[model samples]
Structures are given as C-alpha cells and as structure tokens.
Target: MNKLMLILLALSLLCPAIVLAKGDVNLTAPAKDQALTKLLMTRHSVRAYSDKALTLDQLSNILWAAQGINASGKKRTTASARATYPLQIYVMVKNVTGVDPGIYLYDPQNNKLTPVPKGEKRTSVVPDAVKQDWVAKTPAVIMISYSKPEKDLGDKTLMFVSVEAGAVMQNVYLMCEALGLGTCAVGGYDAKAAKEFFLLKPGEEPVLMLPIGIPAPAEPAK
Candidate 1:
C-alpha cells in the first residue's frame, strides 16, 4: 500500500460515522446484458424534468450506480487511481420521497445519506454555479467533487481524477436511463462559486453536476 491508501485507511478507521454498513433497502438484481445495452441506446441528456418525486429505492440505486461499493474490501463500481478515491458525492434533494429537502453526502460504504448544512441554499447556488434555470428546478442534483490528492503525486493526479469523475457520471447516466429517469451532465459551472456554495473543504473542488428527475413528455415530432 502507498501513502494515499494508508491515509484513506486511517481515515476510514478513525471516522466510522462517515463509513456505513451495507444498504438495507432491497434492490432488484440488475439484468447485466440486455438492460444495459438497451439503456445505452436510449440514453440522452434530459434538461427538462417533471414534478414527479423520486422514491428511496430509486435514490439508493442511483447512488449505488454512481460509486457504491460493488465488491468486497471496499471496491467501488468506478475505478480510482491507486485506490485513492478522491471523489465526494453530494445530493441536493428537492423532492425525494421519505427524504427531506436538503443537501446530503453519500456514504457509499453504509449506503446512506448524511445530512449537510444549508440544504435550502441549493436553489441560490444553482444560478451562481451554472446559471441554468432547469438545473435549479430539477428534483435532485448530484454534485461530484474532487478532493485534493497528495502533492507528491504531481500534476498527473488531475487527469486521473477527471477520468474517474467521468466514469462515475457515465454510470449515473446509464442507471438513470434504466430507471426511466432523465439527467444531464453539466460541466459549465463556476468552480470557485461552487466550492464556496457547497462549503467544500480546502483543496476540494466541484467537478461536475447532474440534474436528475422524471423526464418531461417528449414533444411530438414535426
């Protein structure tokens, strides 16, 4: 194990509350081949969302698909460079069944959400970050942040971290498609404003955001 892994292990052991046990919600086993292929073919960036609320099961599945632990020994659905796993997932909930409106951090290990301060601020920050009306109106927004990597790792760390973020986002896109939900991966945002809005720690930076919800009806073809 290298320095980063050792640091992560130490942190996990020290901060048990941040790590969670297996998810209690029962999830239907995913059909690997057929469903995945179909979803890929149908998936599209959806900017408009309906007022439908999301269920706990759907939220659980989406979070799992994003970066949940898939294997033993804390392995995740997405790969991390040297298992550094520098990404943090936060959900801004506007309308989720059984979940109060707020911002919550995804605890992948426990498969739960830990509430964060300023949940109502989600709307105010949306315009500052991306200035997109649809994004602020979505039922939920998943924000992916890059926690600073070790300085000794040098500049290559940014590239690896970005690739990891993309992998997680793709997983989310495919999962949303399978769930009959709509989402758009948003990269056009003010990074500095996001950092302050989300109350990110020093060195942590917001990388991407996904606005997700039930899709609005498609317009009739002309």
Candidate 2:
C-alpha cells in the first residue's frame, strides 16, 4: 500500500471509537480568486432536496471544509477568537451511502467520524427545532455546537463562539455549492433540547444546525 493509505489504515486500526469512513482527502483544489468568487456569487440556501444519497467523499469534504487543518501548525479552515476553538461539529446521517444512519462527531485531528448513540432522538425534535419538514428529510444534518469557554472570558465568549459558528457554516455552504450539493443554515431549534439530546457536557450548547442534501431540480420555466 502507498504511504498515505498505510497511515490511514494504521489510524483506523488504532482508533476503534472512530468509524474511519474512507473519504478522498485529495480533493481537486480550486483556483483562488475566480473560482471562489463564482462559488460565493452562486451559493444559496436549498430547502428542497432530491432523493440522491451523499457519498462518503462528499461528507468528508463538507466536514473538512468546515474546520479541517489548514496550516502546518494545525490551524483550522475557520478562524477563532484567541485561538479558542470552542465550536464542535456533529452530524446526523440519514441517507448517506456506505454509512449507517446515526449521529457522528467530527474528529478534525484524525479526519474521522465517531458514532454516537441516540441519533434517532433528533427526529422527534426536528419539528420543534425548526418547524420545517425539510429539516427532518435531508440526508444529513451538520450541527455546530459551542463548549462554554473559560469563566474568565465572560460574555464575550458567546460572541466569539457565535462568530466562529458563522464562519464554519459559511465554509460548509461554500463547499456544498462547489460540490453541487445543497444546504441551509437552521437556527430555529430548541437549544436546550438539542443539548440534552446530543448528551453534551456541562455548558456545551448546540448553536446551529445545517441540513444538507442533493438539491431538487429547478422548476421548469413558464
């Protein structure tokens, strides 16, 4: 096996907690200015989705776009205030190919998905959270959560976390647009219920939920 494959295999064997769903890390890098500008101009929220299933590579790219290591020093794709990356990413998988339906946490360090229990509980709360049918029907939902910062930071911490979540969500949107997929940022959820459902630690709060899928076909012109 190649060196990279060998390393990935080793990681999978060592980390039993993470379900190392194979994803293409070597995504085709896009040109900086023109491509990015195009993506930004065309990106839009998509609430309706087709039945097509998302591939593991697509999921990996989406997660990586949110907070993957960008620099040699392990800086993230999204910036953080005081480098306090309090945001955590969780995904609810419902119709992804090659992955079981469940809730999984993104391990940026390892680039793997770690399964968590009680993912189905999210279904019961989707309507209460957003009151939108699409939220429950999307193939997957990416949730950005915040772990309470040190008490010393005070209320500014919430501001920083919220900004960081915005950055992460924007990255996901741009990535989805580039990948020809669709996603919507949803904030109309019951935070308390989501926190409890996700079994978050004390002070951890679910900040935003992004429902993603293959967008439905455009309506025919009149």
Candidate 3:
C-alpha cells in the first residue's frame, strides 16, 4: 500500500470515533417512498439558474445536507481526527428568502448561519475559478475551508480533512437532487480571491466552492 494509505489505515485503527463519523447520513426530504432514483437520474450540473430566490426551508435543507450535524450534540455530520472537524462552510448569499444577501458562516455549534459581510453582493467575490460566468449568475456560493488540524498530526491531517469535505460535498449534491435545486462543485477557484472575499484567517484556507440556484430552463433554438 502507498504511504498515505498506510498512514490512513493506522490512523483509523487509532481513532475509531473519527472513522465512524465518516458514514453517510441519509437525506430525510423526498423520503424513501418517493424513489429518489428519479432525482438522481435527473441530477445535472446546472450553470444557469433562475432569478427567483430560495425559501428558508430549502436553504436549511441544503446546508444541512452539506455538513449539518447528524447527532443533536455532535459538531459534524462526518468524523474528524480527535474530532477536529477542521472544515468550515461559508455561504455567500446573493438571494434567498429571509436571509439578507451577504456572506455567512454556518455554525454547527449553534445550528445557525451567522451573517458575515451583509448587504450588497460584490462583483469580484472570487476573481479566481477562472472567472466562470456561473459564479455571478448563481444566487449563492458555498465555500469550504479547512482550519489547520493540530500541526503535530502532520500532512496526514490534510488528507483526512479533504476526505471529510468530499463526504459533505456528496451530501450537498444528494440534497440538491432531492430539492430540485442546481449545484456545481468547483475546484478551479483562486484561493487568494476567496480568502479575501471571506476575510479568512491565516489557518483557515479556502479549498472548494459550490455555486447553487434553480437552474434556468434550456432555451429553444430558433
């Protein structure tokens, strides 16, 4: 096995609480009887979304899907080494019902989204991501960041944090599938731009960004 794989295995053996926390949390919406298979089949990476804003419940459901705590008392939906759960999810809201437009931080501890830079949307929120048009077209963007795991853990900590982020991303996608919302996971972003946009701290580094909305319908060619 590769060195990283061996390290991961050793860590898993040493930390079971963190390992079990990585399991999937089944989505509650759309329910089991509704045949989520249909939603999965229709799921697509939508780049163009409608101008309409999302309702509170929709917003809550999607955020929960991304990284909502599974247990009432737990801090993360997925596990972390020493329960580090180093990742942070930031919501950049351009339009959503009840939620004033601005960047917000999802605090699993309080089960609430705390507003950051509230009010108007910034045009250059993220100059990176290759300046993809979808960034501006979408009403909201979710940014993932990792707070440095105990440096004593070494580079292994980064791998663990990344794996945890993957699970959270899947949760977001599945929830979007159930809710009829559109989402696209992006990694080609300018980390510097995102860091500035959120005013991230030294230890907090932006890793991924997902822009979401109700996709605009495909236009008919004349």
User: Which candidate wins on TM-score?
Assistant: 1
TM-score of each: 0.79, 0.78, 0.75
Scored by lDDT, the top model is 1
- The residue-by-residue lDDT of candidate 1 on 1-222, one tens digit each, is 999999888988997644566764545555656867688777788887788888989988999999899977599999888888899998888888888887888999898998887655454446777788878667888889988765445778889999999999999999999888888898998989877766676778899998888888871222
Model 3 ranges off by over 4 Å? 1-39, 117-130, 150-152, 219-222
Error of 2 at 165 (Å): 0.5
Give the CA lDDT, 0 to 100, for residue 122 in model 2: 47
Off by over 4 Å in 1: 1-33, 120-124, 150-152, 219-222
Task: Indicate the TM-score of model 3.
Answer: 0.75
Ranking the candidates on lDDT from highest down gives 1, 2, 3
Tens-place lDDT digits, model 3, residues 6-62: 999999888655466567554445554566666765666677778878787888888
**All candidates: CA RMSD (Å):** 18.2, 18.3, 12.9
lDDT score, residue 195, model 2? 74
